[model samples]
Target: MFRDEKGFRPTQQIFTEVPPKYDILNRILTLNLDEGWRRKASATILEENPSRVLDLCCGTADLTMHLARSAKQSAELYGLDFSHTMLARAKEKVALFGEDRVKLIQGDAGNMPFEDEFFDAVGISFGFRNLTFENPDARLHISEVFRVLKPGGRFVVLETSQPNNRLIRAGYHFYQKYITAPIGGLLSGNRPAYDYLAHSAINYYSIPEISEVLLEAGFSKVSGQPYLLGATAIVTAIK
Candidate 1:
């Protein structure tokens, strides 16, 4: 059964509860590789030269801010997340770039509150995995992404994954378990949260499986690029 199956408040609630320390713990847990991953994912949007972009799970607006600054053709950026605390920080960050170029809203990924074909591109960073387990509703999220994007829109996702190389995988597991979790717990006082992070990475589907999901979700062409020695991956699909 999924973690939320047993009367747990939604993941949004969990994020709200932990919002105070979420960014700090995230930086510590990834040793700041998290930012680099977002950078790589945002590059895909740049390639598409999208004028309007949607960033799902735009926690703290890190990627949203990056896109606003970097994408030469990106004139408007919309960030959506369920947690108000996360959105609050994101709003503050977006302000640094001027409110006219960026907007932040509180919304669910599986059920985005946006119109069909409203955006030129969509990007998700470390957010899809939190939508649901084995994500039965994943297609809903993808469908919404597809629906909100104009024809020929690009959808890009950056997520954690198991490395194929045995040696690197083993080392990655060790770091996640011993080094990442302990530090995360110390910083956030939420050992279980960090444990959940590690477990999700271990139990989530392989890149190929995720690519299949994207295709089933109605994306025309799906491709994945592995990064950080395959500890993380970015999947790009066209609507």
Candidate 2:
């Protein structure tokens, strides 16, 4: 497995240790807006009528399920995440859906296990920020997405973004630093992990910077739309 500078191994332990409360904490922290964001991201792909879609860094496959349900066409969805525990949960979710349309795979985002031009669309939600730090080569995950998408395919990335509204931004910062960590600690017993999530969101690229990276990855027309008072942004690019 690839190791970041911090020696994080993308292990199953991270998810297994926090699996029971992961979705609950997510809903509480986002006030249930997370589902709406996932729906919006899925809608973008569905509007394009893709037949085969790839969900990169698909923790627990929630967004993958959303895409499967939302698509107008009969779609085959593949979800990839490095964590086995997360994949297990994803498989459980797929079983509940009772459809063989969704498949989950254990794979790294930077180096996927698929041939080039194999997918009609690729989507990621709240996961790109964990790719790496310091070395921009770690950002090759975007390039890999590009390589796997067929010509004219679409890519959607939904991630947390710094709010532009002053008051909202201040409130978000406070909540992330104080409220989120404590609540996550109480629920998941992993204050440090939640703290890392907050810190990573704080340090991640801005909308324009992320757009530039998508452009660098050979996406033709990259655009970003802010959501929930700019607390998150959805970026869409066409290959």
lDDT string for model 1 (13-69, tens) is 547775467777777778788888888888887686888888988888888977987
| TM-scores vs. true structure, each candidate | 0.91, 0.90
Clash number by candidate, in order: 0, 0
Query: Candidate 2: TM-score?
Result: 0.90
Candidate 2 C-alpha lDDT tens digits along 69-153: 7775467789999888888888988786675778889987878999999999999898876664344655587788888999999
Worst 10 residues of 1 by lDDT: 1-10
Number of the predicted model whose lDDT against the real structure is largest:
2
The deviation in Å at residue 222 for candidate 2 is 0.8
Candidate lDDT values, in order: 0.79, 0.81
